[model samples]
Target chain A: MPKPSPKRKMVRFRDRAKCRFCRENVTHIDYKDTQTLQKLVTTRGKMLSRKRSGNCAGHQREAARALKRARFLSLMPYIS
Target chain B: MPKLNLSRVYEAMFLVDSGDAASWDDLVKHIANILTRNGAEIVGITRWDERKLAYTVAKRKRGTYVLAFFDLKNGLAVVEIERDCSLSEKVLRTLLLKADHFSVADMRLQLGEDIRQDVAQRLMTERGETAAVVHAVVSKPTHTGGEPVLPEPSGDYEPRHERGRRSERY
Candidate 1:
């Protein structure tokens, strides 16, 4: 039998366990609060995915809705 | 009597040219007329903001936003109000939203509150500054003759002795 190749040891970094909104206990996401929304979007004006933004599924949905509304009012750009 | 519970609250934002905002009182009344004409009760109307738009609408570079809250019994009233806004020359854009989530008190807070001052203060605080530097610039000053005069240069005005050299060069 061929000798088993050496298993690479997996190294773990600092724990990123909690979503940002969950950690802060945010109940509502306001589109008028552009500062917070800007953090959740990429530089290109595209929304970051759940995994990238670390937002819970519920907050992510709310953020998406707010972003769309903001875009319609020209509060946020549709494309950068 | 018609059902009292049929009316629902709504939030609307109207975009108008900043130049035309000088007649906001008349504009607000016009908007109220439109809403009341369609059986909508006006809760409040306020100047929301005056700012540079991210994109121009109706060839207007600067826009003044008017925020209004109202209660409407029929959903079709929204369509009629939208039609009126589109037909009106004063209004550039209009956005109507069902605001069932907002309480009457919260709606009152939004009315007549301009957030620009708050934003400026927040930015100053974020920069580790305690006070705001407000410089009021008057572009034109009315002279005693009642004609507008160009404002004096802001900095110390040292008469330019070098201005005569251009004539010598000719």
Candidate 2:
């Protein structure tokens, strides 16, 4: 693995970009939108943290809730 | 019942046993009634996907999904609805979630954009054909180690007790 980042800003410009939903101006992250949530999950079926998703605190919380809801409903797999 | 709901948008996806009714419409209606009976104003409902489960549920290995968007008049009704869904013989599982501020058009779009049905239908048809092919292959005598071996289906196909009782009846 590469050396840990000394500063989050020093990370790749594309990696620390603005939140996804924020760019679209979405208030409520819809859990029923499986297609969108599927992209946010890892191949191993793990949730990416806000730091990784580059989401603001609010959007991160919404995304977490939506992801958990989708998993409970079997709409999304818990593990790939 | 008292109406306490602020008319929030809610979505539920139910896994219904397709074996109960092969007709898609009948399966959709069967699941919709469970929500409608509890005063849920359905916005849009559509067939989601059909496939075998990772594990059997209620002795059913295969099931299909019905995705529904509705408004709850009473927030507490969700718990009751979930209970009813669990108790229903036709419904294997149900997931209920609060989808606040989702518009009718958004729900309509979801219904239209769900493209799992066509592929699942084709898979279901293929499953039937594969089963027939397997049956034919097993029925025919196959050469094994220079000897023709016949399929011993009767001994393996059913439980011993059930087969014993069935034989007694005959």
Candidate 3:
């Protein structure tokens, strides 16, 4: 039997243990933090999902609803 | 005796005068103390800091923003909060939303690390670019194959790219 070529090693990776919302001490995430939340919010004014956002579970939940409430209050754009 | 259960969570965002930063902190603390005394669990409190408003409110050009998320035993607390906020001169505006199906687990899944990185990258890229247009195309449900019908523009102005095959039609 012909020798099989060596199988390529699959590289596995893990995400860093840091608050994605605040990588640096200076970065802040606020509901009125429209500039920051704007980056997280969808054009439709919905907060992006965590699976998509990579934010820790706690902050993601807070950020999502914050963005939504911000939109309803006209603090953020529903469609922009 | 009857068991008391609360099913609704609420998220509130309000604006305070930026000039009175100390008063703003005190106001938030007062609201929180009231809620806790009334059996409400404070879920999270985020200071949104200050920024320019999209439009003027109460003749003010700019205001400080604050967000408070909590769970109340019932909607009664919400009503009281709203009433108090309405009467407060320092509170420029306030909005409270009932979170029916709020789940932290689901939210975390939606904003995982990879996604945050992408958002960070997009923001950086967008900042480098000028006047980028964001196009939102909603897909229509298919009917028996003819040509896919596009929704008509509801506004007087339509983008040139969306006019589609104008020369061919002419």
Candidate 4:
């Protein structure tokens, strides 16, 4: 009898959570709104990736732009 | 090109020392004069906020922000205004952005009675016309609700349960 084929390891992928902006129907991400932006960044003031922040591709792009603007205005810190 | 000379809306934020807040009227007039001198039409002007800086800028710990909206035909006017602001002793920093997304009504709504005396009077007389126009333009959700409410640097974004998880991991 032929040897049984070795079992291959299965890779598990987590389902993506819904983006907060999409859930709230937010169209524009205001750089002045630091409260919302704070939630999207890490403690060290680095922006979180879409997977980690639960932002959709579109909102993630806007968030990145807004965050950079906020940093320039000194409305948000560049680093903690 | 003709398109380059076409009028466009712009939003500018001016940063000044909080100490000069008393002479806000003068600063606003000064800014208005600069825009007018550059052939820009004044649409609206408002005081955004006064707050402590995240980082020291121009050796100032606190600053006051003045927001202005205008229509300008010359694109070079923006460069000229920025140059003037930098040279002025009253202004510490400035940030200007294209504001085509906003409408005249939206801009007018931000105009306070304390702004330019003539503009304020004109708005008072044309209140009905302005209100009708406001309904036509899609209103923006107000983001200038004073300063940003900063939560504690710790334990705000993270949930209570998740807070302990970090310590446990270490």
CA lDDT, candidate 3, residue B145: 29
Q: Per-residue CA lDDT of candidate 1, range A22-74, in tens?
A: 78766667655555667766554667666556677898898899888777777
Assess each prediction's global lDDT (C-alpha) against the native: 0.65, 0.61, 0.53, 0.69
- 10 residues in a row with least lDDT, candidate 4 chain B: B132-141
Best model number under TM-score:
4
Lowest lDDT sum, 10 consecutive residues, model 2 chain B, at B133-142
Docking class of predicted structure 4 = acceptable
lDDT of 3 at A51: 43
Candidate number with the higher TM-score (3 or 4):
4
What lDDT tens digits, residue by residue, belong to model 3 across residues A1-80? 97654452111113456656556532224443455565564444445545445567778777777676666555775664
In the range B73-92, model 2's lDDT, one tens digit per residue, is 68888998999888888877
Q: Which whole-number lDDT from 0 to 100 does residue B108 have in model 1?
A: 41
Which pairs, if any, clash in model 1? none
- Candidate order (DockQ): 4, 1, 3, 2
What would the DockQ be for model 4?
0.23
Most DockQ-accurate candidate: 4
**Of the candidates shown, which would achieve the greatest lDDT relative to the real structure?**
4
Fnat: each model in turn: 0.17, 0.04, 0.13, 0.28
Q: Which candidate, 2 or 4, would have the higher TM-score against the true structure?
A: 4
- Candidate 3 residue-wise lDDT, B52-105, digit = tens: 565567887666666555667666777778877777777778887764333432
* Model 3 error, position A33 (Å): 9.6
Cα deviation of B13, candidate 2, in Å = 1.3
